[model samples]
Target: MTKLRQFSRNLAKNGLLFNLFILSNLILSGCTSSTQPTYPKESIDQAIQDICKKEYKTDVKVKLVGSTLWIYLPIPEGIVEKSNKPEKFIERFVIEQNNNELKDEIVSVNYLIKPVPEQEKLQDMKYSKAAFDRINNVWKVLRRVIFSMEHPEQNSPKFFVTVTADTKNGFLIKEIFYYPDFKKVSYELMSWGEYQHRAIQETEVSPKIIGDTQGLNLKYSDISFEDFILQQIQHRIRLKFQKPEAEKNADIDKEILKIIRYTLKAYGFKDFSTLELNNLATVRKITLNQTAVFSGSGD
Candidate 1:
């Protein structure tokens, strides 16, 4: 009788363990199946092209980088030449895509349309490849550094900067910056609720500021100190300028360095020696002597 009772208990224990093993296997399989790529690359590419062409009347080249898709559209030479407003492109596209069907299909999307040289010709202006290249390199690095600092745990963050130049009115330059919307991510639970890791979409975080000939004369009150620091790091000056013709005799690279020195001096940084200019752009990492306060009024 005692032996039989022991055997019964052992069998029940083994049955419970076996059932748990089966349940766990099922759960693991479900998770794996859920993660399998459901969106085909070809379908996404086709959809983006079709939607962009039909809606915006523009042809786009699609490139898939990891889970995000990049849509590159060349600016129409006519539009860039005639319009003094390149900032309109940023505003128009954001509104167009807000309720579009494409937004639902993709985890993230980046639309890039850098100004073309043909547009410069239309404005009777010459293209400064050297100047533009320097600007591009600086903006790229600045964006990367800032994003990494902000989201240290995030492995891959979607972001891009669009630089547009309009020499029609004293060498106007517009920069449109975009990044993934991190603010929407939720971290709260109810009494009888389950937890979830919410997904977020790309959004425009910074204001689209246009830098022109007047950018050289920007005052301390015109821009926030923090933003000023970033612009210096990116080599993007928001001050107004006189004219490209005035700068024709000046060495742009040297002028940029002078501006950096002047700006740092205003911020009360005596150690200007720490500032370094690489082959492409100005790069610096400095710790302030005091806590810097960013003004609310400046762009």
Candidate 2:
């Protein structure tokens, strides 16, 4: 009887060990299967292309670059030929991965609309070197004058504007505004294209203002000053370019200079010299010669 009891106890212990081992194996198998994601790349690509075609009414090139998917929509020649309004067609493209049941698989999606290239006949038109040079000179003058007015105490505020030709468009202008300590205050991009000459955008980095007044009176408060100057510059350029063929390309420098001076006067600064393309660097020293003459209130 004692031998039989010992045998039964041994059998029960072995059976328990075997059951525990099997349970552990099943648990590990389940974890491994769940951790692996099953995402069909081809299916996702096809889905995106189909959606884009339906939305834009045009075909798009879909490319998966690493974790990000880039959808390139070339501006359809038919659309451009039929419609002259580019802004109307420039709709913001948003792709919701969760709605498409791809939130767990795809990392990011990008929509890139290619710029409309000038027609072959239009491309044959020779770019005006003289016009480009004049525009560039005026831009430099504007930059120098604005820098001087903004930082009267600092000498040679390191301001620069670069104008370059765009292959598809016309001209690209990049302007940089710098601080007295030689750091960048703001950067702006303006495009002088065949269709439009306008301010594209401006980006600025917030500067750490060191002063006793803590919360309200910060340097960021005067951030709009740069934007105001840029807007005036763009406005003058746009007026020059957007005029009728007979009035277009009329002496831009004189008009731009007059506008700048009038704007400065309105803002209570009269000592600023009229910006001349040749004498841009000469106006490094600026003085506030008057107080607020116009209250900017309409009668």
Candidate 3:
């Protein structure tokens, strides 16, 4: 009876161990689902976004060969011109995949070159190439991204830059843009920050100006310094965004008027007697013909 009990006990122990092993295997397999996140698409898209933030001194040369793209951007030396003191020239390379295939769809866009300036002596240049790269280098990249986002349908692949070795330690990049159907798009320098600051400024008194003075005929002497600072900052921010006159051509005066009126209303003005924007180019003035009336939900 004792021997039979021992055999049964050993068999029960083996059976429990076997059950635990099977349970662990089942749990691990359950974790392996097809819905889990993976790379390839997301990672590549992030890489492209990063490329748009880099700066090149002279120009970046890009070429598409089958699945791979080549990028050659220059790295400028601190060799500034005899007179020009603030800028150094450098180049950078970036690549984007054109074909949809993932097989061998690798991009090689990591090269730099330096462009020499047209000066006999590289003496008076004080700032280094790193300094120029720090300041104005990313502007071109930002412009390209803006252009791509703005004119997606109209832009074609032929619109790119090509770089090659020139004599005398210099290089040249031929700007080109090609379509998938082989149509060519002429290269043009994109205008960046063209509409950056274009708005009208409005002036208004703050509620703090009439804080405890309860009367329709409040004095301007009651206005506080805090109110003054707030108004000044608001005015400056508006002026900083004011559009250039040339951009306002083509009789869009109605649109401009609407914007100005909306801005005034937002700044807590009720009824204005008159509002006139002066096109007097010599003065650059905004003359109000009359004062504003009031009465609204404010206490």
Show where candidate 2 strays beyond 4 Å: 1-227, 242-246, 270-274, 279-299
Model 1: which ten-residue window has the lowest total lDDT?
Answer: 192-201
Query: How large an RMSD does model 1 have?
Result: 27.9
Model with the higher TM-score, candidate 1 or 2:
1
TM-scores for all predictions: 0.25, 0.21, 0.19
Candidate 3: C-alpha RMSD to true structure equals 32.5
Instruction: State the TM-score for model 1.
Output: 0.25
Which tens-of-lDDT digit does each residue in 1-299 have in candidate 2? 23223322222111222212322333334322122222344343354455445643434343443332332322211100111321111112111110001122221111111123222211112223432333333333232333334223333323222222121221222222223211121121211131122222221122221121121211121223334444544443333322211133334334443444454553443332222222122222222212321232211
Clashing pairs in model 1?
213-240, 213-241, 214-239, 214-240, 214-241, 215-239, 215-240, 215-241, 216-239
Q: What TM value does model 3 have?
A: 0.19
lDDT of each: 0.28, 0.28, 0.27
Best candidate per TM-score, number? 1
Worst 10 residues of 3 by lDDT: 93-102
After TM-score superposition, the amount by which residue 133's alpha carbon in candidate 3 deviates from its true location, in angstroms, is 3.3
Tell me how far the alpha carbon of residue 98 in candidate 1 is from the true structure, in angstroms, after superposition.
Answer: 36
Shift in Å, residue 219, candidate 3: 42
- What's the CA error at residue 167 for candidate 3, in Å? 40
lDDT of 1 by residue, 136-155 (tens): 33322222232334232353
